[model samples]
Target: MSTILVTGGTGTLGRLVTERLRAGGHEVRVLSRHAQPYAVDLRAGGPGLDAAVAGVDTIVHCASAPRGDEQAAAHLVAAARKAGVPHLLYISIVGVDAVPLGYYRSKLAVEKLVGESGLGWTIVRATQFHDLVVRLLDGLSKVPVLLLPAGVSDQPVEVSEVADRLVELAVGAPAGRVEDMGGPEVRTFPSLARAYLRATGKRRPLVGVRLAGKAYRGMRAGGHLTPEHAVGKGTFEEYLARRF
Candidate 1:
């Protein structure tokens, strides 16, 4: 069996990836800050990173934060190069190039670093996860009125579907910048918020406000959506029904 090291193995996507890999009878190592023995913070770059990446066949990089993602990717790349890791697969958002947000820019930078790292690499850009959309609605539901951005739409995919795809890519040979993964449907924020309210049995008025920003404009223009690549099976309504 091949040995696979999953960075951010304890996270939402990483945990699922680790489980799937282990279930397939592969030797899986979970590398996270709290994971014993391989507890290395990628953003800080340490000796533990070198140890974690050594002799692994593939690395499913799912660790990410709002900030410092570029630093984390650089450290991980350096460690992977030193360990002679053959394959490095990264998970990125769909609109990193189109969106003008700071986090999206960081993700795009990481993508470039991986592509030019002189190692066999693959990058999969998927739409936002259903969980993130739920979290956004949750935060906006704190009051009687739910404020959402006008004209902004998202194709939220299932996290498990993304993890499954990542596992498949991890086992296969590196194919740079493969087909994008998108959800089954493109939905507006207000519509999704309504779905959440219906599933949770909460009553709230959704108000869509027009925002002036490049990022908002990008989102409104459907930069974050991939209608042609709607390969994911799960729907947001299904997720809401199951979750609630």
Candidate 2:
């Protein structure tokens, strides 16, 4: 069996990826700050990380930092190259090329570095996670009035489904920038907010904030969505229901 390294093993997507790889009878090593197993700082690669990459068949890079995506990817790529690692799989957000947000920009930078790293790799751009969408509204709910960008929609994918796909990619050969993964359906934020309000029993006035920037323009034009590639099964409604 091949040995696979899962970075961000404690995070939502990474945890599931670790479990799936182990379930498939493959040896799994988790990269985390905490003391579970295979703990190493991907942001700062050293001997521990060097040894981790040594003899590793594949690395499912699920770790991400908003301000340091490129640095972490560069470290992994260098170490993986030095150790003769066969493959590196990276998870990225959908619409990174189209979105103007700083986080997305960093993710895109990482994507470019991986492609040019000359290592066998696969880059999968997935839609926003259901948990993240819920948490976004949760943070906005703290305010008396929730302001949302008008005409922008969110397609929330199941984190577990994305994990399954990542495992599938890891076990197989590297296919460069495979098809994008998205939710079963795309829904507006207002509907999601109303659902959140109903789910949490909170009362707040909803305000639609109009936008006129490239970010909003891209979102409005559906630059981030791939309806033809929408393959996730779990719906956002079910995701919310499971939380209660």
Candidate 3:
């Protein structure tokens, strides 16, 4: 069994990936900032990281801070190269290059870093997770009306399903920028907001306000969705029912 190190093992997708890898009989180590026994702060980049990356066969990098993702990826790439790690896998978001959001731009930078890092690597770009949609709705529900951006379409996939794909990539050879994974269906923000309202019995009014920006227009153009590869099984409604 290979010793696999997970960068964001405590996060939503990271935890799921760690579990799947462990179930498949691989020894997993988590790279964490808080040091929860299973992880160390690989984000800081020092002897701790050198120690952690040493002898690890594969590195599944899922830990990403919106502002620090690029730096973190650079750190990982350097460490992976120094350690002579075999494979490095990254979980990215769909439309990262198309979307003009700052975070998305950072993600694109990291993509470049990993690609040129001189290690065998694979990148799995997945659609937004159901949990993110729900979390956004939950915050908006606190207000009298749920406010949403106009022309934005979301395809929310189950995190565990994405974890499955990442694990599959982990076990297989690197396949740089493979087919994107998306939710079973795509829906507008107002549509999903209404579904959440009904599910949670939050009788809030749904409002779709138009915004002026290239990013907003890009989202409205469905830059974040890949309908052709809607391979996720769980629907937003199903997730709402189960979660709320």
Model 3 spans with C-alpha error above 4 angstroms: 36-39
What tens digits encode model 3's per-residue C-alpha lDDT throughout 19-125?
Answer: 99999999998888865554555556777787788998889999988678887788788988999999999989999988899999998889999898889999889
What is candidate 3's local distance difference test score? 0.88
Q: What does candidate 1's lDDT look like per residue over 74-127, in tens digits?
A: 999999999889999999999999989999999999999999999999999999
Model 1 lDDT at residue 26: 95
Q: In angstroms, how far off is 200's CA in candidate 2?
A: 1.2
Candidate 2 lDDT over 81-200, as tens digits, reads 999888999999999999888888899999999999889999999999999988999999898998888888889999999999999999999899999999999889899899888888
Tell me the whole-model lDDT of each prediction, alpha carbons only: 0.94, 0.90, 0.88
**How does residue 152 of candidate 2 score in lDDT?**
85
The candidate that wins on lDDT is 1
Residue-level lDDT for 241 in candidate 3: 88
Q: What is the alpha-carbon RMSD of candidate 1 to the true structure? A: 0.7
